[model samples]
Target: MDTLLSAPILFFMLGSIIALAGARIPFPEGFDKALAAYLLVAIGLKGGVALTTADTATVLPLLLTAGLISLLMPLLGFALLRSAVGLDRVNAAAVAAHYGSVSLVTFVTATKVLESSGVPFGGHMVAALAIMEGPAIITGLLLAGATGVTAVAAGAGGGTMSMPIDDGRDEGRDEERGGSLREAVREAAFNGSVLLLAGSLLVGLVIGKPGLEKLSGLFVAPWDGALSLFLLGMGYLATSRLREAASLSARLIAFGLVMPLLGAVIGLAAASALGLGLGDAVLMVTLCASASYIAVPAALRHALPTADPGLSLPLCLGISFPFNILVGIPLYVAMSRALLG
Candidate 1:
């Protein structure tokens, strides 16, 4: 309970309440972005340092497993959204992409919980994070193509059209379609977050523990404070968009809540099979269960423009993000302890 009431979570709540009450808190422009960059780099460097001492035999298998989970998660999400929830191809794929990708904030929060509880985890998990970032996006794009929803140039009116994949209007849009696919892949693999996180991990790996110790004053000491500020911004952004989410169908909202639970179950089974320790298992489950709000959204907006951000963004940022933080983390931790015992 004390863990639940930590400063970061409280700041998040405070931000949400203030936003809900229509109070204006002036955060400087680009402050959020800078904070995000700092957190990613710090996490990466920490993970890289940890990776130096991690048993390669164990870490290698976990990376492969995490990558497999990342690849398959979107397929499951897409199938469920299409068959059960009755979402059309484009929206379903878009939502599935978000589900397949991991949320950095959720992972950071879970790590905090693990640390508070005195459970140790491997730094290779950061590598797992970087690895898991891209596969689902590619999967979403492939699913979109399979459904025949190709990206075309905007109409002369500067308005966007939500056209089906098989629509006959795609006669001469080959160049545009190819460009979008390339762009999506680029965004998914090399976005600011992924690059910084991956780069920091490599830096940590090369520098090892001595480097981390020397730099702890900058990266380690202020981590919690940075996280609290970031989540405060997140809380404001998440709740401010609730009005848009209100338009989503009950079925979609249900999927947002339910998918995380399903993912957690799969993550637990996989981690247990791989013989992960309790703390690692909890982090794995949390990663599997959380959905991306930051990186994937930007990719989708550019790559799959016809896919409504209104539908996918709210479900991820508003519903799943909060649910995972408040409820899912504790549940996964309890499950991990029970299973590992």
Candidate 2:
């Protein structure tokens, strides 16, 4: 409970409350993007510095395990959505992609919790994070294709299939050309967020501790404050989109709450099987449990155009994101301690 009441969380709640009450908070333009970039760069640098001392043998296996988890999570999520929640193919695949990916903000928050608790984790977890980002996107795309939901329109009509005609002759020409998939894959792999994180990680690895020490004043000192502000923005975004969430069915809402728990269970199993310690286990659980609000949304906008952003965004950003931060993080930590100890 004390952990839940921490400053970052409180700021997030305050922002949500203010937004829900229809109060206007004047945030400077591009401030949110700036905060995100700063946080990612800081985290990548810290991870790289930590990697300098990490054991390669352990890191390799953990990275592979995290990647495998990322690939499989969407498959599980898609199946559950289709069989249990009864979401259509496009919506199911789109939502599945989100669950399969990790939220950088949530991962950062978990790191802070671990740090405050005096828990030690590997720097290579960042590699795991980067690796986990793309596979689920691919998997979701494949699922959509297999179900013939690709090229659907991006509206609230729920997976109605339609293709735009260029001069009435290009109808089905775009589909035949297979251009959209290529674009989505490129976006998923080379998206600004992924590139910055991966590049920063590499830079950190090359520079090691000396580089980190030199840049610590900028990246390290102001991390928590930046995160609080970013999360405050997140709070406002989530509540503003809360109306969209009402369009989702009861079953889909239940899936939003349930998927994180399931992911955590899968994470615990993986961590235990790999003999991870307390902090790493918690972080692993967090990676598995946290759904992407940033990367996947952008990719899906291009990839699954017909997959309603209205549905997936609200479920992920508004519902799952908050649940994981407020309730899921502590729960995963407790589970990690009990198991890892």
Candidate 3:
């Protein structure tokens, strides 16, 4: 509890408050987008620097685990939503993929907290993070494909089959292709987050620690300051979106909050089985526990247009996101230490 109320969390809360209150401040919305780009770059670069700290042997196993989690968890999440929630196939799968995937902001904050508390994490966790984003996006599309196939089978000679994705600000667009699994794979692999993360990873690998250390004085030096400013913008964005829409259902809220815990526990077990240290375990749990608000939502909007974004995004960014960043992280760290140590 004392750990949860530490300075970093308080800084985050302060940023959230500023974001919610900054509506009248005369900055252009485009400025916020630029801030987001900076945040992403900073995060990617930092993750790269961290990766440079890893030995070769530790890197492979953690990277492999990250990839497997990215592949497996989304499929499991989709199955659970379909069987239990009765969401249509595409919607269930899309939401499942988002929940299964990673959140960059959450990952950044977790790393900071771990470092501040003097917990040593593996550098390859960033590799794990970079690897984690694409799989869930692929799985969501696969789930959508199954839905499309089922619809085709059931409605032959009857009606058109449409699978819609919903995001709160606007209606989603379809992937603009049909009847080719290869195209789906291409779309998933080439998504924006994958491009950025992969680019950053390659840059980091090429630059190595010496190069990163030179740039770190600028990019890494005021990271907390940058994150606070960025998260404040996020808070404003979140609150404005919330004000524009109605509140979410209790079930959806529960789903958002609880599902991450399940993912974290699963990740803890996986890390322990793989014999990861405290830092790696915490990062693994954090990645599993964090839900994607950016990449998955964008993919879902294109691939599943009819689904409700109101249900998905709010539950994810609004409810679960805040809970995980503020509360779930500290709890997960403590739990990982207790179990893995």
Candidate 4:
């Protein structure tokens, strides 16, 4: 409820509704890329700095649990989509990848909810975040039996990659060769968002408290504002294909909505088993509950060419992202509180 009222979510919905109503909100060129980098770096830096004082040994279980949850999530999703929903393996795997991966924006939004509630979460969660992105992607690709296809760009926050990766051949050659699993793996591993996030985390670890404090003026105070603007841009991009969501079969839409809940339940189980505190538990639940609109989609484009973007994109961005923001975050928080407090 209160989560729905926050500025970031409001801006997201405002952008969405505005776009839905057939209006345009212009942003400066490359604005989204800048915001995405800043957000990921800030998240990494904060996590890294926090890791300085915290006992690293304890963080291991949390990271391991988060990774296992991420890997397991998509397998469950694929089975449900195939058995109950009747999607083919490729599409099911594609959509499953989304369910398995975390949405940085959604995590950020959940953090805001915790902040408003005065709850504190561990920065080691960022280390968890770093490991969480790639495994689900690889799992999805493997389950789909994707050898690989053409490369596509997904920025850190902009949904575009930072640099173009040439696959040792021109586009025509790439199409003919049918890029290998290695290519897909590379995309998942070095994705702009993932690379920046993981890289920044290392940088943060190396720099520690002193470094974070020196840069606090930039990354700390103004994070929410940057996030709001990026979400607004994402709203425009998401709604660009908004009709895809509207066009989805009822079952698919239902899958989009339901998968997040199922994911969250498993997340809660993991948290309890690991004895995570309230804040980390909430984030872990949110992480599982979040479907990736970021790295998964890009990797899927290269990995599963036959997989329909229409279904996957709408489910991830349109149905799941908003549901998590408006309804899921607070619900998961309550679930955590019930379990932990």
Best by lDDT: 1
Clashes of each: 2, 1, 8, 6
Estimate the lDDT of model 3.
0.72
The lowest-lDDT stretch of 10 consecutive residues in candidate 2 is 156-165
lDDT of each: 0.87, 0.86, 0.72, 0.81
Write model 2 residue lDDT over 1-341, tens digit each, in one string: 87677778888898899898999668999988999999889999989888989998899999999988998899999999999999888779889999999999889889988877788998889889998998888888878766533375446343456433235645454573266567677888998999999889998999999989898889988888988898898888878777678888899999999999999999999999998888889999999999998788888776677787787889988789888888999999999988878
What order do candidates take by lDDT, descending?
1, 2, 4, 3
lDDT of 1 by residue, 36-89 (tens): 999999999999999988998999999999888988899999999999899988
- Find the 10 residues in a row with the least total lDDT in model 4: 155-164
Candidate 2 C-alpha error for residue 256, in Å: 0.2
Higher-scoring candidate on lDDT, 1 or 2: 1
Deviation of model 1 at 179, angstroms: 4.2
lDDT: the better of candidates 3 and 4: 4
Between candidates 1 and 3, the one scoring higher on TM-score is: 1
RMSD of 2: 3.5
**What TM-score does candidate 2 get on C-alpha atoms?**
0.92
In model 1, state the lDDT of residue 77.
Answer: 97
The residue ranges of model 4 lying beyond 4 angstroms of the native Cα positions read: 146-179, 239-241
- Distance from true location, Cα of 316 in model 1, Å: 0.4
